[model samples]
Target chain A: MRAIFLREFFGYFRTPVAWVFLSVFLIASVGVPWFLGNFFESNDASLRIFFRFIPWIYLFLIPAVGMRLWSEEKKSGTLELLLTYPVSLGQAVLAKFLAGWLFIGLALLLTAGMPLTVAYLGDPDWGTVASGYLGAFLVAGAFLGICSACSSLTANSVISFVLGLMCCLLLVLLGWNVFGDLLLSLNFPVPLVDFLASFGVLPRFNPMVDGIVAFADLVYFVSISIFALCFNRVVLHR
Target chain B: MSAPHSTARIEANGLSKSFGEIQAVRNVSFSVNPGEVVGFIGPNGAGKSTTLRMLTGFLRPSEGSASIAGIDVLKHPIQARLRFGYLPETGPLYGEMTVVEFLRFVAGARRIRSVELDGDLIRVRKVCHLEKVWHQTIETLSKGYRQRVGLAQAIIHDPDCLILDEPTDGLDPNQKQEVRDLVNEMAAEKAILLSTHILEELEAVCSRVILLHQGEILLDESLEAMRKRHPLFGSVKIRVAPADADRSLSVFGKLEPFVERIDRQGDHFLLRSRDKRNVSDAVLAVSKDAGLALLEVAPVIPRLEEVFQELTRPQSKFIEEQG
Candidate 1:
């Protein structure tokens, strides 16, 4: 398991995908706050603006990091070799998922300079800033798990990327006003509407960014990640 | 159940796999003992790869099971896999990594520690003749060198068994000979199963041959036994005088016990005999009775190609019904 982790971790740098993902993520996370959100003016005690945009940022970058996780192995026919090793399918999936998630986490850490600068320039709510980073990490982990599962189901990296994006988009759309309004007009039961709303990205993620570590929310994201990873193992075994 | 300790390095019993409606392998079974080189020969899409995959536990068999070094592969695949090294057809290499780096990865995967890493790497590099190209990236190396790198990784763990698929594919004649020599040297201790389309390679390297076709084992025998079972009798060419032709033909008819069949062309007789050992005795008897001189008796050895063709010929309805 350790060997697989090291190989996969270093393998990220051997290809252009990791670098491209990091660069794009750093530029977007940092650049968007300065150019679009006007980080210096009307600054609150919180890094609310940056946290607000992370879901959109991860919508693009997480798939890029996860698309090649298993799909490349299938494409190159190395999955056979990998499976033949003395490693269990669960261990293999965990190693790959952790490697990709850690890569994105590293990129996110590099962008910490933004919040540090915000603190240096004006008083900022360090708790919200820290919670926001934690939320981003959890969201990235959840999306990465989904993308890794998608990658395992196909040999084409492009198909995996597109499917991952679609899945993430659907999850986000579940929280939108348009979806809720449509559900209200359809006269759906109140419980069903509330249940569907809980399925959305914001309902679960917004609490984490506000420093509220609700057990249900934590379970929701962790469950999704575990479920996706286990699904990946099943597909590879089949 | 724990496997009984034995010299056998690999064993399979009625292993089978099916992909939807197609049966890729059906009750295929064989074994390789330590220090023995076995050749697997079959036509394209004949389940050689599928069988190898099952042995390595890459694909779960739909029925039956396999084992490596007494470890049940399906029940404990990781344990079985730890005892064997495999080289898939395409060599399954990371093109971006240097040859040395790839070896290091394999060594680490096999759980070789830093203390033993240098020695293991040196041993594998020396055996595979890969020292010169160690620092070069795999993508930049030629196909032959890449294959060498693949071989290096396979042996890096010092497995008790090695399963190689087309080990000599895409190599020049000289490179092929080098690999053959390396395989020969390694065969002294490791149980090796190699699949190849090249018949001569089997003759040169393998002690036994397993001929497969349509997911069935057509033949399994030692090289010497196979040769003896289908021995190539020498062709006897005799030019007889027209007056003595009838007598010579009569003598040839008496020689049917020693000969497979005979063909006639004018006054010439071409006799294909099964008794290559007593060729001179048969020729002497025919010469004395027919008053015809023994012109030529040359031995035509049968090549493995001819043996393979004859063994794998499509079965007719009569043969199928009998089975």
Candidate 2:
């Protein structure tokens, strides 16, 4: 597992994907607040505006990171070589997931300029900033897990990316009002809609952005990640 | 370092695999003793790769079992895997990593202790001639260099048994020779099972050859025994003028009762028979009848190529069924 983690983590930098992902993510995370969110004009000392665009950016970026995790290995036939080693399938999957998640975490860390800039200009709400970062990490992990699951379902990276995008889109839509309105209009059970909305990422993520660290929200994101990883294992076994 | 073991280093019993409706391998059973090189030879779709994959634990066998160094592969995969090195047909590699980094990663993955990694890696690099490309990324290296890197990774742990599938598949003659030489050098210490369709590859390195045809074992014997047991053995070769070739062929064709096969080569004809009966008299009589002069005639020794062809021929199935 250690070996796989090292190889996969360093592998991202071997190509342009890691660099490109970091730049795009950093620029979007910081630039969105400065140019559109009125970071300077509002005189608000919190990173709440910056946190709003994370889910939308991650919906595409996390897939890009996770899409090749298994698909490239399968296509290049390296997965056979990998599995034939002493490592178990579960170990391999965990190592790959952690590496991708850590990579996204590293990208998140690079955007430290955002909070630092907020701190430089005024007294920033450090608690909210920490919560926001934590929430973004959880969201990235969940999205990465889903993308990795999609990657295991096929040998084509493009198909894996598109599949991952669709899956993440569904999870994102689950929390949005449009989906609930559509379901309500269609005369679905109100209890069912309420239960699913609670499961969506937005419900858990919104509170974290507001410095509200609920145990239930933490459980929600962590469970979604664990479920995706379990699904990945099942797909590979088949 | 090259001491031999008394027990079989690699063993498979009644192994079989099926992908949905297709039964790719059927009851394949074989064993390799230490210091012995076994060649798994077969035609395309003959279950060579499937059998190797099953033995390596990359693909689970639907029935039966395999063991390496006395450890059951399925029951204890990591233990079994630790004892053997396998190179699939493609020699799958990490294109982004430098040769040294890749080798280091394999060593680490195989769980080699940090203390021994440096020494083992140095020895493997020397053995594989990878010193030149140590720092070069795998994708930039030539195919031969990449194959060597693949080989280096396989042997980094110094396994007791090695299973290679078409190790020389796409290599040039020089690279193939290099791989063959490496196999021969390593055979003194490790039990080796090589899967290849190339006949000469077996002849070059294998002491024993397992011939598979259509998911069944057709022949399992030592090279010397195979050569001697071939029906083409003790055959006679005769050469006559081009004009007499037609008449000589006709004459030899008439002796179909005595000849197994009559192979023609320019003005030369090779007459094979299952029995040691001297057919020279019949050939002389035919030459006289046809008013042809025999240029030369001599006893011919069958080659490994002929033995392989005879064992793998479609008609051999009928013969085996009848027998």
Clashes of each: 1, 0
Report residue A81 deviation for candidate 1 (angstroms). 1.3
lDDT of 2 by residue, A58-159 (tens): 988999999999999999999888988899889999999999999999999999988988899899878999999999999999999999999999999999
Please, what are the lDDT tens digits per residue for candidate 2 over residues B13-103?
Answer: 9998899999998998989988899999987889999999899888889999999988899899988888889898888899999998998
Task: Give one digit per residue, the lDDT tens place, for model 1 in B1-323.
Answer: 22433544888789888999999888989999988999999988889999998888888899988889988987887788778889988887888888988888888777777998999988988888887888988889999999898888777877888999999999999989988998999898889999998988998899999988888887788986555444453556677777767777778887777887778887777777665543546777768866675555544565677667666677533224224
- Residue B185 miss distance in model 2 (angstroms): 0.9
Candidate 2: DockQ?
0.64
| CA lDDT, candidate 1, residue A137 | 86
**Model 1 global lDDT (CA atoms, 0 to 1):** 0.82
TM-score, chain B, each candidate = 0.86, 0.81
- How many angstroms is the interface RMSD of candidate 1? 1.1
What lDDT score goes with residue A23 in model 1?
86
